[model samples]
Target: MARRGVWELEKITLYYCLQGGSSQGTRGFVEERLASFAKENPQIQFETVIEEGHPEAVGLYRNGYKRTLSLRNLEPIEVHDHLLYLRNTWGEPEQKHSKISYGVISNTPSVQGYWRTEPDLEAPSSVRRSYLGQIPPNVPPQFRSFAQLQRELGLAGVTELLQNLGCSKWVVSGMTGVKVKSRKKRD
Candidate 1:
């Protein structure tokens, strides 16, 4: 069909099997709906060819390019949608999409590289080594263990130990540099 201001679509050929289960929907479309569809789009020539394989539709363009859509096992509505899609297209070979689409280009390379959740196994040992099981080297001696901290301070310390172990309410007095701020009991 020659669109007034668009590319010309010459013809569409529908191919379907006569007895295959896969062509049931295509047969239904041909028997019940094809006539009305052809009448609706009068500019294009529609032809049906009996074939022995899966159902498909091929649209030929005046520019010599053709588009094929598989209609195997599709509902009548889906088959109609595929025909509409083929009718609207320009009948050119599809282009492969790229990772970057726009014209914007970065002059500088990424310094930090791609973000990752896990450590890179391919990296150097120093870069990938983790302190997950054993204690990290940067921890202070007093912060290491309660026994070691009690031996260093020489006091029967329970609240201090719990405070060191991250209890914020039990404030330790006199040994650590922090002063205890008394809070009034809430009613």
Candidate 2:
């Protein structure tokens, strides 16, 4: 038979890490998030199986029969740490929302050592620039155009720019532009 999309219910297992290293708290949080997501998106069903230890958690993902969803922070797993592993039995092994792992490491042992040295990080420069650049100086009194409005108000930051432009929120609503409820008074 041909395969279908990820929404098609087969069986899926999810593994999530609990904060601080407590299995009970981690399991509770995982169950809560899973239940909430499942309830919100009724089409997706999730079943969870908790492993005994961190190694067992890893092993469950590595060799378990069912497809799994593992949720973990980018932080490194330290010695004598406990992690939560969630497993599902009905779906494909890899899904579109599957969690992937990345790492940060240093030769020095102390946490302070990593912060002292500069590393090539992919920081969001565009967002910073957009927030910091001065607003232009030719905006109309009514604030009709983006360029004129952004420039005339002398907006020092995104908050002021958005406030002056009558944008109430920052969400992408359509292809053309964000759908912001106008704050301007209706005359």
Candidate 3:
């Protein structure tokens, strides 16, 4: 099978913008920092842009996502760090996510013994249940759980059943009824 991937440019493009009317020193400072960084890593491509009113350093990734950070009044050290940060990124903003210590490795081999097709240890009879302990033991062969009733009733069946019972009262619950709870009475 062919590998699925994005059409990314082999070289990174550091696209920056400084206001045309700004001090010449600002442009000089930015260019100096960029030049130093470019010299440090020769693989990156620098594309400088001077938009008259816009003033920010933008990291234009091969993937087309641009990260723009203001460098208007910042010192050279800060700008240098920002440039380093932008250059090191995968072209996306810091995503909102939790720090996960363990991850699922789908391709891990079973020889490691961590990956298994079946249960490694048999759970105690008291701890384990057949059919998730859902099916009633006394249920006859032909009978099934109230699966259809749950579908027809929907949630606790309060709203729909209330309508069926000719009760005009409105029941306030969330949009999805799978997380059904009894209506709490107000004081």
What are the Cα lDDT values of the candidates?
A: 0.71, 0.40, 0.52
RMSD of 1: 10.9
Off by over 4 Å in 1: 1-7, 100-187
Over the stretch 1-187, how does candidate 3's per-residue lDDT look in tens digits?
Answer: 0114532222433333454543243466556766677787665666666555535666666667877776665556776776667666676567665677445546666665565686543334443343223445555432233334433554356346645655555422222112223455569
Return the top candidate by lDDT.
1
The root-mean-square deviation over C-alpha atoms between each candidate and the true structure, in angstroms, is 10.9, 21.7, 16.9
Worst 10 residues of 3 by lDDT: 171-180
Candidate 3 steric clashes: 0
lDDT of 1 by residue, 8-35 (tens): 6779999999999889999999999999
**What global local distance difference test value does model 3 have?**
0.52
**Model 2: residues >4 Å from true position, as ranges?**
1-6, 15-28, 55-69, 73-187
Q: Candidates' TM-scores?
A: 0.51, 0.24, 0.39
Best-to-worst lDDT order: 1, 3, 2
User: Could you tell me the lDDT of residue 10 within candidate 2?
Assistant: 29
* Backbone collisions counted per model: 1, 17, 0
lDDT (Cα, tens digit) per residue for candidate 2, span 1-187: 1135333342334344343354444455454454554455454444555554431233222233443223333222321122222222333354444246334445668755434355533225674255434444553334335434434543345346677677776542222323457665779
**Which is the winner by lDDT between candidate 2 and candidate 3?**
3
Residue 89 alpha-carbon offset, candidate 3, angstroms: 1.3
